[model samples]
Target: MRIRAATLKLGETFIGIQLAKIVESKNPKYPVGQYVTAHFGWRSHTISDGSPINGQIPALVPNFGGLPLSLALGVLGRPELVRRDRNRCWWSVGSHVGQIAKIKGCKVIGITGSDEKGRVLVEELGFDHFINYKIADVDKALTELAPEGVDCFFDN
Candidate 1:
């Protein structure tokens, strides 16, 4: 979310997180030339004192052990625990939360306004089902898809 600070006033630099390598450092925890993800958006260069920005310290990027260093920016931030049998509305978070739910083994059901987005939800993102509320009867569709009743309903 540090990318593209929407609330900035005129002439203010946007604030966001980015992948950066330490060209120089006085701190031994983060040696010179170490790769780190920092929270200073859109700047080509920056200096960090290893302080916590929004409660996150500048972490020394670990040896990936075959993983790409670019993933250090956020792939590690996903939920470590895998849950199952959950559902949500895709429009609530642009299929992001629904995808995460699917990754956790949930029987996800996404709701959108168009068939294209719905297809992406069910086909590409691996959601169990989708409802395009624009044309279909939501109540009837819900009854057909979840006859046992929906355990969760994410309305946005």
Candidate 2:
């Protein structure tokens, strides 16, 4: 059995993602030189046996038609891909659509269930603003956050 070498002390885990290049491979599904994204944490290197954990293995970074790989680490990176590949069933439609909006120089405001989620949506995902629907009135919050009407609204 393979052992995961911890970067930090045992019994603690970092919840994170990485863009990894396959330097060597025996698996036909993931060839060498291909790029993959996974919740491989903060390791400099990792070994994946191509087994499913929570029904997920490493997912290939999509070919963005020559766009830089660094974009894969940002708003274009994790959300929709992981939502689909890992069977995570995340509410990704709005996030991905917001990503597109941000790319095109539009403002984005994500409405989520918790403040922590809203924080990540705004701070990490390039959203201009976010509202926690669980505690705030969405319509009122939207009015407060953006006195002018928003250009678009997305729901799933």
Candidate 3:
């Protein structure tokens, strides 16, 4: 099999492959030319029988609507599934998570170490509100920002 390394594990000579060509496959799930993302490790090629490792199976890359396939490595893949439950109040929003939450119709309140980053979270990232953990009491900020308490908390 041919692979394009995507993620690396410590001390491993090979890393996860984001783009791969199936030189051969006995499993119907994996066919030649079907691009897949899997933690196969840092190698130009590897062979597998389509077995799951630690319950983690290689997932097929879905259509990206003309978006880059690399986006599957992060934002467009798991994050889309992460935000499926809408109408929740979210806390400590990271940039990508916050944006995805908002797109999924969740109310987002970001927490940052600096006021500048907090401002960016609100102004640039479109978070509904931000708390500078350095300057404000987190407990107090949480109470004020989410009067009914947060429904979700995302730690970057």
Candidate 4:
């Protein structure tokens, strides 16, 4: 099928995608020249929608607004290339995961590297609790905060 391929443009190490041209008479379901997330490559370009990579796994291009395009290539795109739970947390990934989890009605307990980040996680993102791993004893905090035990612990 005609699809965009991420090719290392000559002399450049980065990749770009090749998007299928939109049939003019009807606007393609995925319009051309309009930015949308695709698990295309480390470089920038478009591709034609292709066969499912894995039947069990759906295509991932979680929407974000005003985010730099490169964030898609490096952070968002990397997960599709690997076998990792999308819910894992890191300094940056935690922020996104927390937001998504909250939307999914999951109570989030953010364990961040610093107290300031912890505060932000709770106040700004609506996390149920925050554990500053650098300052607070994680086990004690977690026990007090989530006495019921953790259903999911995402570590990034």
Candidate 5:
């Protein structure tokens, strides 16, 4: 299989996919017309019995309510699950997680590689503040931005 062929190969990484059923399934939970997300690596096809393996479980794609289902693999998935508290500070915010943290009413500070990216994080993405790691000392910037320390670090 392509998965076996790619195993232990340098520069090869597991690719995530949105699976569409081509045949009928015995499990009612995964019907023939349903779409699911699986971490079947770079292979084009895979078989699963709906049991969790390698920390990946075939899950029913969440309803995005007119938003693209692709968001399931991005913002709407693991990034939304990162813990956030309203009274605490959130740091290392990526574009998606920064929006989520802001919605949850946390003091969000984002770190990006460029000043332009930092501006996007704060001005457009609803982050409270941002630091450009390329030019600034991360430790010093973090200290100044969040003196009480970060409560959640959403490392995307």
Candidate 6:
């Protein structure tokens, strides 16, 4: 559930775990400078010596071939098919999510905290439109941005 680099160990209890970069070899699947999100604990490095299940260090850093490591802690690791539902639409995590949604044939409406952020969401991030929640009415903005209803909403 937690990545080693993001974790802060307070004596015995583990606090946080961010994604960690693995020492890569010439293995075709894993390249150098690539990161791996793992449930390794609250340390800068990961050691699998004390694992109860595997009882050994992993030879490879799981299946992290072509996707971004930041997503390994989340959705890209999930095997379920992306589906459209009432809850999947509306909130925007960032331009990355918006661009991904657009690439998946879904309309993306980003709601951000600033005008500059909104501009980035639309102009740079490839969002169909952006609603600035800071300076405008949220309800009205949502109504205007997504008049056709939300198909997916990611809060990041």
lDDT of all predictions, in order shown?
Answer: 0.66, 0.65, 0.63, 0.53, 0.63, 0.52
Write down the TM-score for model 5: 0.43
Question: Where does candidate 4 clash, by residue pair?
Answer: 3-48, 4-18, 4-47, 4-48, 15-43, 17-45, 17-46, 18-46, 19-46
Report the lDDT tens digits of candidate 1 across residue range 1-156: 433445677787666566788898888888887788867565778777888876778777788787645346542223223222223355535476667656756566676778887897888888898888787787778788888865444332
Is 4 or 5 the stronger prediction by lDDT? Answer: 5
Candidate 5, residues 47-124: lDDT per residue as tens digits?
778887567888887666886443555432333433322212123325666686678677878766677776777777
> How do the residues 1-156 of candidate 2 rate in per-residue lDDT, one tens digit apiece?
013444546766554566789998989999999898777765668788778634568888888797556556643333232111111112665677677778977777777777787777777788888777667877787788778865344444
Rank ordering of all candidates by lDDT, starting from the highest: 1, 2, 3, 5, 4, 6
The deviation in Å at residue 109 for candidate 6 is: 1.0
Cα lDDT tens digits for candidate 3, 81-120: 2332222223332577778778977788776667777777
What RMSD does each model have against the real structure? Answer: 9.4, 9.9, 10.4, 11.3, 10.0, 9.6
Q: Is candidate 2 or candidate 5 better by lDDT?
A: 2
lDDT for 12 in candidate 6 is 53
Q: TM-score for every candidate vs. truth?
A: 0.43, 0.42, 0.46, 0.46, 0.43, 0.43
Model 4 TM-score, 2 decimals: 0.46
lDDT by residue (tens digit), candidate 4, 1-156: 012224434555332332222333133544433444433434443334544422322133434586534334333223233222222244666687677678867777777676677778888878888776676777777778878866555444
Q: What is the lDDT of residue 156 in candidate 4?
A: 49
What's model 2's overall lDDT? 0.65
Worst 10 residues of 5 by lDDT: 84-93
For model 2, the superposed segments whose C-alpha errors exceed 4 Å read 1-90
